[model samples]
Target: MNLESPKVTLDKSTEETFNFLSDVKNFESLMPENISKFEVLEEDKFLFALKGMPEIILKKKEAIPNNKIVLGAAGGKLDFSLVADITEVATDKSEVQLTFNGEFNAMMAMMIKGPISKFIETLATNMKTTV
Candidate 1:
């Protein structure tokens, strides 16, 4: 399954935004408000659990300089990757799009689609305002 967010323009430059996202600790600012727990596990890993969801660990899988960041599930029931695509718009502005890619059976997708969609959308929304 693939869930994507609408592109959002940010008030910072691509370099600035990329630098911000390069740090795993910064992701806390982009999480959903209802997250029950959050912890930075390592330099490139973090753990979080949202309401009604089991704890999940995410680690930086790859980064393409100031262009994109790919975070993959380190250990969890579901396998997924969250990517942040950044594009330069101006000297101090950029546009970002968030994509959630997961391999889920039809039944699992149906069961979690709503929350998963909301989770990615909320992260994208928060990035637009606070990233």
Candidate 2:
């Protein structure tokens, strides 16, 4: 497992941002089509169909409106969750902060860190575009 955190501020209202973030299908739409496929499961969890990626699946374990969400994946043979928070910054802006924390075996740590970081960065960028 690897711990990774990435975040961004969006120039949109909290309600608008929360609405967009609350829907898992929106993430599928925002992701680059060439890189992966996304499938939404019940209760806001999802399975990420990634190509040329080591992890076969990614899951969103928890999501709360306008506050936080947690996603997990078995990367490099270790299970890890990346938690993220969305908070109101002002009347027309919101901030997102991602923090990673999980148990990682020694072997899995190095391999998962960079890619997960990149994924979080991409998520922030894509979310901004959507907002």
Please count the clashing residue pairs in each candidate, in the order shown.
0, 0
What's the residue-level lDDT of 64 in candidate 2? 79
Whose TM-score is greatest here? 1
The best candidate in terms of lDDT: 1
Residue 61 displacement (Å), model 1:
0.4
lDDT of 1 by residue, 12-116 (tens): 999999999989999899999899999999999999999888898999999998899999999768899999999999999999998999999999999988998
lDDT per model vs. reference:
0.92, 0.69
* lDDT over C-alpha atoms for residue 120 of model 2: 68
Candidate 1 ranges beyond 4 A from true positions: none
Which pairs clash in the backbone of model 1? none
Candidate 2 local Cα displacement, residue 107, angstroms: 1.7
Candidate 1, poorest ten consecutive residues by summed lDDT:
122-131
